[model samples]
Target: MEKERKVFGISWNVFLLGLVSFLNDMSSEMIAPIVPAYLTEVLKVGKLAGGSIMGLIESASSLFKVVFGYFSDRFRKRKVFVFTGYALSTVAKGALAFTQGWLDFLALRLLDRTGKGIRTAPRDALIAESSNGKTGKSFGFHRMMDTLGAVAGPLIAVLLLGLLSYLPKEVLYRRIFLISAVPGIISLIIIALFVKDRGGEVKKKIAGVSSLRSRSLQLFLAVVALGTLGRYSYAFTLWKAEELGYTVLQGSAFYALFNLIYALSAYPIGVYSDRVSKKALIGAGFLLSALASICFAFAQSLPLLVVAFILYGLHMAVMDTVPRAYMAELAGEGEKGTVIGAYHTVVGVFAFPASLIAGYLWNTYSLTYSFLFASAMAFLAFILLQFD
Candidate 1:
């Protein structure tokens, strides 16, 4: 048998998958950082409604993760779902240029998220399969690539906004949305041409169903749920930037800074997690998140907000990259997709309530109250991790 090729100490599939994510994320992040502003400023939606819309958009795809994951395992296919999901998202993003109202935007956003739901689990399972016992390194590299695109995305948007300064703000935003689809299309092409299907064997019974009985997994899930509840939409961060008297372009730059730190830190942290305790690292991440929230709550200067965003980026580097590797480690032979799907589902289900709560606090009390709530919840999650 021919030896499988490796790139950057990972399989070809993993490398190509990372490339796909990089491009796709470039497309997504272009919109992500600006969506809240778009909703409130362009669509004339209120803060609470904007939060609810953002929350629903974030969780919409998560609702499909487990179902599609199980189907991927049962059907013994990955590429098809991955391709279909990317296609759907590309089309939806392109269609954003035509949205006339909040409802139209919501519909397109949900479709884009649905695409994410369909692909995430199966794509992750493929990465886990290709890890070669280096799950941490593989996932880290992938996240690094993905986040690098995130860094590039808002920067691109900033550049576009600057160059298109002559156009109306609404026209400029819509044009950027249309342009975002190009990267998504390129990502799909890469997937079609380079990514190979490497599905696992079919099992007589689903291992995902049995995984629920595991006390450790259950505890981990609870920790994730709590952490997610504290994790508000990134839109709130952008709003914070605006509240500090920054322009939309400046806010996008801050968003890019956050992603740049996340991109730079993810691979090193992921590699370190392999040598040390993932639980310890996760606990630290929660602590950092709490600190970030506290900083955001009290930030009165640009320098302090910068510190908060840096801490937030570090939290993302740990929470986003490590947990996927940990879940893959916990998964049985053929049930990686299902188990990862469950993790995503938990995060997704809780995200709605979490964002709603944050929005409510923001609308009813104050922005400080919202940040304090996140701080409390994250601190609580950190405490819970000790029991695990």
Candidate 2:
């Protein structure tokens, strides 16, 4: 038997996967913080339309996860899907520089998300396979590395915007979008050279969705579905900053701060999740999300908004990291990818209506109403979790 390599006490595959996510997230976040402003201010789209677009884009990205995940498991090949997904996203993101209208932008964004949907479940299955029983620790470390890119990406955008202050806003944003593709390209190279496929073992029958009979997983899925309805796009947070009179550069800085907190907290939370109850941690995260939404609803100043973003970051860390470990643990060995894909699909499907409802509330009513709706849903999710 060949000896497996370890990095930072986790499998080499896990560490490399984290590095891939770090670079990819850096590429994605560089453009993410500014996208809402670009759509609303530059493209002259309405807030409701912008919100719907973002939600649609996000949901589209995850909708394909289940199909691709099943294919990966069925063929017992993980690396091919992973590589193809990254490649598609890289092309889509780079093509953003050429889009002149919202329709074209939406097309490219969908392609990018399709890539994400293709890769997510299989990549997560890779992480689970590589964890060697340290599921929580592995996922947590991956989240930490991934978020560090999230932290760096916005700061980089801030710096670029400052440097290109003399250019027209449209040109500057386009240039940043072009430059963002570099990290993604680098990630692809790493994936091609380093990421290994561990799904070579022959199984007599690959498990399908019907095999996901675990009661705990079903309850977890329901809780995630309910919670997702309240989880609006991050654009709303940036929009709130704009409403409070902060510049885009300042908003990016604030986003970087949120990612910093998430990065710092994720690993410890992941490690603790191994020792404690993942359900309780996820419930606590939901509660924090509810409180954060309430704060966003009432925040009138930058400081209050900062506090809200901090809480949001903490909750994101828990919701994003612990759930993967929990789901991996819940799944049987032959069905990890399918089960995780199902979980992601549920979140994605619910996110569509969630974002639409949030947009309606923000458009027809007020931002406060939208946030209050989010808080109410999150609180309900937290309460429902108790039944599990």
Candidate 3:
């Protein structure tokens, strides 16, 4: 009898890509835990400004995804954009160390997210194409690596903070920012050395524009957009932890917990989706996210918030791995890059407003309102998926 392929295994390309992401997220998470604190405490930026900066960064990245993904597809190139993108991010992170004020920070974040937007679609397309039928596994493995970095990033941040407790606050943050650049450099090197261009698989129709005319693709993008519309920035979670009386370190711990669960579940859910319908998994993820958001809105204490965050992590795991896999399954060969980019761009466009709206709600209404708004959007998205 023929031996079955290893279910938990990934291709060399996927593994290497995962390693790159892992390193990158390590750098990202290192900053992520400190960002809200840095802005509010050190930079003296207000919540509205912080939220706006976050929204703009997300939106800018999505916009770049649209342009870069299309360009890569049309030109049949991926590595150059991918490499350039990572290089931009590395530079952005280094610049963050010397940021003078809110404007400088905003510019740094914009450039950083631009890199993210540029790289995401093409990178995902590469992973999808390489994995063949194991789409869920591929994305899951990648996410797992990414989350591992996420877990480590914050731990290192907290450790550094503790180690440098004797230093002035500004000096402490500058040191951490400087150190975060290490992973970025490492990731750039890995991508350059590995991750060759696997060009021109095939072209397929996309759904967004009426002239383009891929009904299913269009429908999927629309559904994803609507779902993402309620998807607010996760910084709110960290912010809420602070509002609810958690210390900076405590809040970071919660963020770490969230990533831990998210990392652990990513692969299992991916594997499970391979056996079951990805549609069901995606729908479930939306609903669970809604539930988590609601719990977060009502959470009175850190423990309850931890519960909410854990559910949120599970939601992230499902959404991260399954949706793209579903998209790949939906798209025919050769067009995966364009289709994926278009889908993310659409989602990214919505995410920009979603985060902005959440910011507005948080400032004008309440954090509860912001989360409830997200929950409602998630429900609408889930309902629309019924037609799928």
Candidate 4:
């Protein structure tokens, strides 16, 4: 792969996108942990309802990413969708402070996710376009910044909540959520100032679906979807840790450590990817995820859990960023948004079922079974991607 030269080996756009994600994540994380508490403790909803609401939000986010992605490509406009997505999420941050019930919160959550859905594909394509030859490093840098924000978000929430302890607990929670608006606004400013508006150029409008259905893209997406089917959310890892005699404090610390490991690894991995083969790195990522999942399944000691989580971070660092870089490489010029959108759409469509299967296996048999199944599927993806 040829490394596209950029100012400082990465364009200003990469920095801007990374910064935008950092701020957005920090804002989102500040409020995410409190949502369940507000729903159950304040609104009197059951646990099942809260979980279902989150599921809905995830699905909507994924679906909208596809929808907005198609439009982004169809119209050849990226910045406007990106701008709108951030704006909605920014508005949602403020709304979270004022929600009266679970349903209200659900609406805000969906709206927030809708913003995410709109921005993801086009933003990714924009990043890829800016860093033509060095997708790995650029995307890696972006992920690193984003993960750093994820790590910081929870800490900010804690600090803010602590500072507002004089207020009633419920009021304090709302206050904490309200503070998220600051970062949201800042990110929007950054977006307005730094993000370029790459409106579409005139070209023969091919069917977006047909463009996305090239034999190679189809095969790649199939492999990716199969791998994603095995891949469920990270909450199970925390559950596994708690089950293994770890306290909530330990589990929380472990998650922060995992994010730290993920952030630290991404840029270096991207640099290495450019020097070597992205496919091999992607395959290695799945295998690493398999290894990490197995570690989660059998963690008995703190040391083992640490290793598992670190490897888990590594798996994501590789799997998450490298594949996008590869996708950018694989997508045709005008079809980047559509092809990427289709890829995520497949994963979103299958995610609920994947989670359901994982939950069922964990509930019915053993958590080990779920992890093993995921490992096998990821390994299979790695193998299949090689042929691609």
Which model, 3 or 4, shows the larger lDDT?
3
List TM-scores for all candidates, in order. 0.97, 0.98, 0.93, 0.87
Query: Which of 2 and 3 is the better model by lDDT?
Result: 2
Instruction: State which candidate, 2 or 3, has the greater TM-score.
Output: 2
Task: Give one digit per residue, the lDDT tens place, for model 1 in 11-74.
Answer: 8999999999999999988877777778998999998998888888888988899888878877
Candidate 1 at 348: error in angstroms? 0.8
In angstroms, how far off is 335's CA in candidate 2?
0.9
Count of backbone clashes, every candidate in sequence: 0, 0, 2, 2
User: Candidate 2, after superposition: displacement of residue 317 in Å?
Assistant: 0.2
Cα lDDT listed for each candidate: 0.89, 0.89, 0.83, 0.77
For candidate 1, the lDDT comes to 0.89
Candidate 2 segments exceeding 4 Å error: 202-205
Clashes of 3: 2
Model 4: per-residue Cα lDDT over 43-134, one tens digit each: 78653454345456666678877678778877878988888899999898788888888778888878888888888888987887777578
Clashing pairs in 4: 4-133, 76-200
TM-score of 3: 0.93
Q: How does residue 264 of candidate 1 score in lDDT?
A: 99
